[model samples]
Target: MYDCIEAIKQRKLKKIEGETFLVSEKHILKARNGDEYVGLKLKDKTGIIDAKIWNNLLHLKDRFEAGDFVKIKGESNYYNDNWQVIIKDLERLDEKEVDKSAFLPSTKRDINKLQEELLGLIDSVKHTGLKKVLEEVFLKDDFLERFSKAPAAKTMHHAYVGGLIEHTVSVGKIASELAKDYDGVDRDLLVSCALLHDIGKVYELDATTFNYTTEGKLIGHIIIGYTIVQNVIERLNVLSQEKKLNLLHCILAHHGEYEYGSPKKPKTREAVLINMIDMMDSRMQPVLDAKIDDSTGWSEMIKIIGKSIYAPKKAPKELL
Candidate 1:
């Protein structure tokens, strides 16, 4: 079986096997010979590469769709400075043969450690009502299992298993630290908001395949989170009028702006703080994911970074 990186280098040309990755583009085209060609963005844990079928083959289109695991045989070549594969054969593989963990990109942080740290912050909240609400929701048997395994996004930042917990914990830590320096922001409220801002993601994405559901696409995480939080508050019957309004406002405004998916602008100081912290974590994901080995000066093309160039400042010769 050929791995993704080896296939890209053309070192394993005889037979290549790996899972098919459906990126943004999946379409059919007519080749120069007037035959229909199928294109694919095949990927595995290491990375992705461009691939194409030279001619229409038997039941090829129906057999494999984007996000499906398949064993492929292809010869590799270079095209316009990027690796391309000419697929000669393909077959769908059993779910057991394909490890889902190997396909999804994951956060560099530890999920368990992050969860513990976040819980510590939650326990420190001075407000009894807010703390109890957060603990009741997160510490439950059923919610904990799903929250710890869910993806933060369908394709954006932290779009892997256990990503939701990682992102929420990271943002919570940052928001907590920021609260110490700023006045008029309740530290407990901010911390609770950070921990719960993306809770809707657990419902938004399908845990089995880590893809968006129809409800996620239509209502979005913001509205879904609001609904979930409101229901929990009603059930608990412990939050004060002011606390309920403040917490709800934070959830609604965590996305920052209506154009950014937030239904309302941040009305409370804690909500504003959570919005900023959330933005920082989301934007930094691509930068962290694009890192290469220390020995290699050249890294993969960061599609998100685009044409804008950033040069790391040169260190002194002694330091090197």
Candidate 2:
């Protein structure tokens, strides 16, 4: 049996042998001297760690692909202030030889509770047409099951089993709470959009493998979700044209900006609210999940936020 990835500490040049990991990403790159090396992101339930194979790139290149389970012998080293493995040997493992559950990460929250909260949020929508459409889309097939299991993202916020529902419920609660304080805000529309914004991720990410599907990579979650919700709206013929467009717009613009992959910038109040809530949650999750550095009183640099976070070991007594 292999030890968990989290067992390796930062700055510790520890030796690891006969350990297995799921290759989440792989890259082949050239050094300044024109030598090639392999870069990888390896994961196994506890956490993910960066790794590199500095030599024999050509011989090891064909041994495995991203998403495959591989057995490795390596030594751990601190690079860029993060723990990483310098791989010496690697071999791909047969699926039958490994327990898939050991390699997949899962949410710590209760899946059933999150599912129930999401269903309650959907039921809270007073708009008859919107409620019917949601029911038709989520309750008709195996979608609810898949959605409950799907990760909200590949590596960003909520990238684990049951992550979709957890994020949806959290977003829904935030939207509803904020709607109550803001006059002229359509609470129903805002809440509905929050609950359904990332629904396409159910199909976009492979729930088990945690990799983007062909359609997910080509079309993306926003367009995929827009199409999914739009189809339901059209098929039911229950919503007014204006309401239908507003709902779809919220999903299309939740990414907030065009450069952020949102095809449409948020035009309506509800769209703007969803976009803000989505961005807030996505940014906060990584900081909240990171392990603080004991020496620097800071977190490793978060690529999404573009800086390291300060989380000192000792807090002010007053605050504590």
Candidate 3:
């Protein structure tokens, strides 16, 4: 049923009817003629498309919010080299009416296997107090369940089910390898902070919508993660004051710069390493996943990196 979205992109269909899509975002705007319109980012498992409702905005605007599943009638059109839908009619559907998974994008990797890798990384920690903190933070079933399912972000890289753990494991592996390469690096602290860095995203983003929660808009993931880690440290009271501060500092400064929402800048070697690795993973993901422009063999311009990624098609290998 949702496959038509792909067909729209492939130019196999020009109009859509009786199709249901998830509203990932919604915006109300005015045209030059001063008529209000509803703009939306619609998604199904196939992919996401932009949609606009230029008529009857007042009636349709309030019918659904971002994250609601909606049935829609629209025509597919291309403008500025992108495929989008011009919606004519729309109605919100109850949650029970649709398969939730049909609209949510998910990681291709085995989530269970990724969780196992995270647990394995935690097991490799040699610091007694840090190891305890990792176990207390991640080993709990409730937290594990949420962390395993939550997306890494709303629209940025790894923004899908199981994205948080996928990103975490990636950063953890990078930090682990870097620790081995660099002298005087605290592998325990670097790896621990890497795994814990974005843990707050589980709460920051709604489980189903992947939208920012009130707390996320106000406190953000860095501070939320810092507080979560701080509470665990206080309860345990096993780490030395120095280590505790350093651990929390790493979380608070992981974004690296104040302009980037980091409460503190990376002051220690471990914190610097965490920041770089985190940036590396975050920046690279979108480039890797970008939809390449067929004619240019380059990806659509990525706002985060301020450039398009060169991704020419590769010839298929001969199968023996």
Model 1, which residues run further than 4 Å from truth?
1-43, 47-54, 57-59, 75-88, 101-103, 293-320
TM-score of 2: 0.94
Residue-by-residue lDDT tens digits, candidate 2, 10-73: 4433887788898988999888999889989888776678899998877898899998999998
Better of 1 and 2 by TM-score: 2
Candidate 3 TM-score to native: 0.92
> How does residue 302 of candidate 1 score in lDDT?
46
TM-score pick, better of 1 and 3: 3
Count the clashes in each prediction: 0, 0, 0
Residue 291, candidate 3: Cα error in Å is 2.1
- Position 185, candidate 3: lDDT: 92
Ranking by TM-score: 2, 3, 1
Give the winner by lDDT.
3
RMSD of each: 4.1, 1.8, 2.9
